[model samples]
Target: MDFTPAIKLLNSCNTVLILSHHNPDADAYGSSLGLALALRGVGKEVVVANQSGKVGRFSFIPGFAEVVDKIAVNNPELIVFCDCGELRRVGERFEQEIKTIKCSTINIDHHATNDLFGSVNLVDEHASSTCEIVYNLLRDAKIDIGKEVATALFSGISGDTGSFQYSSTTEAAFRVATELVAFGADAYFVACNLWASRSLAALKLEADVISNLKSHCGGRLVEGLITEEMYNKHGVDSSEADFIVGRLRDIKGVEVAVLFRKEDDIWRVNLRSKSTALDVSAVAAKFGGGGHKAAAAFRSKMELESFHDQVIRELMDLFEG
Candidate 1:
């Protein structure tokens, strides 16, 4: 849908408040802050907030340090949501507060599952990243691209497109990226900081995960497991294992890569597919999670061995189908 009307609505509204999902990722935080920066550029009063202040490693973008902890919904005229598709991701604590707001609400996202919950929605599943959409929206509104806005938008583009390595990377994504770079985004420095920086504990976890990698289905599938012991031994949190699954997916002939980690009382499964025809979201949805075709995740209370068997069976069916 065209965002011209949404742009007009934003211009008319005052006291704009922007929010993203809980445990905000690069796309979530980047897009929200990028939009907020653009809104502020046009003499608008904007406040950006999230459910949690625990920033991820990717929060090094220019405007990222600006995300506030508390929500200041003092007679706000507009509440905008970015990169959050489902209400569950917003958490129940903030749900009541957000719904209680007496203002026009807008939901701008790129997820397929979005229900258009807001009075105005700019959901486009074909868009490579929410940042791409935000860039176009700001451009449509004739808003100047400042350095802070450019940096935040570039972070979301690079992150959601897997540094322009995923299949979803489109020509428009590159175009927006180039424009953002021209607007003073430090692409090289941001890339280095995001892809290069790693803690000693994270390095150890990666090493252990690599050592434990297993090949299956005649080298067509690769799987790795990171147990609670691994975390304890490395003195690291579960998020330190984030990069392991992507590394597994980079294997030469592997069509599918799976990473399993213990989360609380269940196993959290992250699946990635190198081939285009494989929709990993199907597998994730079967359990209780959902995502895109190439990347998806799910969680189950089943033991590791049982979960492995169930996943293997589902993937085998996918391959055979």
Candidate 2:
């Protein structure tokens, strides 16, 4: 889709507020900082913020230090939201400001569940990641994407596409990679930090989660649950648990993989499908959640056992249907 409206809107703004999703991932930082730095290059007063705070792994990206833990804006002429499927995905703190945003709001994302909340909504579900969309916007705006710009974009692509291992990796994504490299993106740094730099705590979390893995549907599905006890034992927190689903998805003979984390009174659910026989996003939507076909997620209010049973039943239906 043409990103002219977003380009024009961006060019028209003087001071802009840029925000990314909660629990920010590679794509979140990639798109947010890539756009934020580029806007600053054009002399725009830019505020790049993520409610989850800056992730250490992504600190290699330029402008990562500037990503605020919270956004503070009184009356921005433009508010640019990147990579979030819904406003709530950006964290609950933004709810009041988002409602009263008298300025033009721009929503640019790749999530299938995006609600088109922006005055200029640029949602391309088929794109490999929102970073891809942001890349195009930068190109259209004729921004000079130097080394840092390329690095931020590449980090996002690598993050969301599972370092080019996920099904979301597309030919276009690779093409964009080539262009970013030409613009001086550091691929080796991305690999070393984003993938190879896992802490001891993360390794323990992975080992513990795998030891407790469960399987069902005759091995077509596998799951792992991380409770506060497990996190405490591993000397990690929910942030380190992000890799659990990837581990489960690697098991042989598994078509669907899930990872659940008990956080307070709710369970955070993550889903992945290796086969086309299921649309996991539909499964997530059944519980007011949304994502892509191969990957999706939702939250559960039921007790751990109850939510486990409920999700397993849905997985069975997805297979049978």
Query: In lDDT terms, which candidate is top?
Result: 2
lDDT for each of the candidates?
A: 0.82, 0.86
**How do all models score by TM-score?**
0.91, 0.96
Model 1 worst lDDT run, 10 consecutive residues = 84-93
Clashing residue pairs in candidate 2 are: none
Candidate 2: deviation at residue 223, Å?
Answer: 1.2
Error of 1 at 138 (Å): 0.5
Evaluate model 1: give its lDDT.
Answer: 0.82
Q: Flag regions of model 1 displaced more than 4 Å.
A: 264-266, 300-308
Q: What TM-score does candidate 1 reach? A: 0.91
Residue-wise C-alpha lDDT for candidate 1, range 230-309, written one tens digit per residue: 88999886755777788889989989998998866878799999976888888888887777788878777877876678
Residue 49's C-alpha lDDT in candidate 1?
A: 84
On the 0 to 100 scale, the lDDT of residue 64 in model 2 is 94
After superposition, the stretches of candidate 2 with alpha carbons farther than 4 Å from their true spots are: none
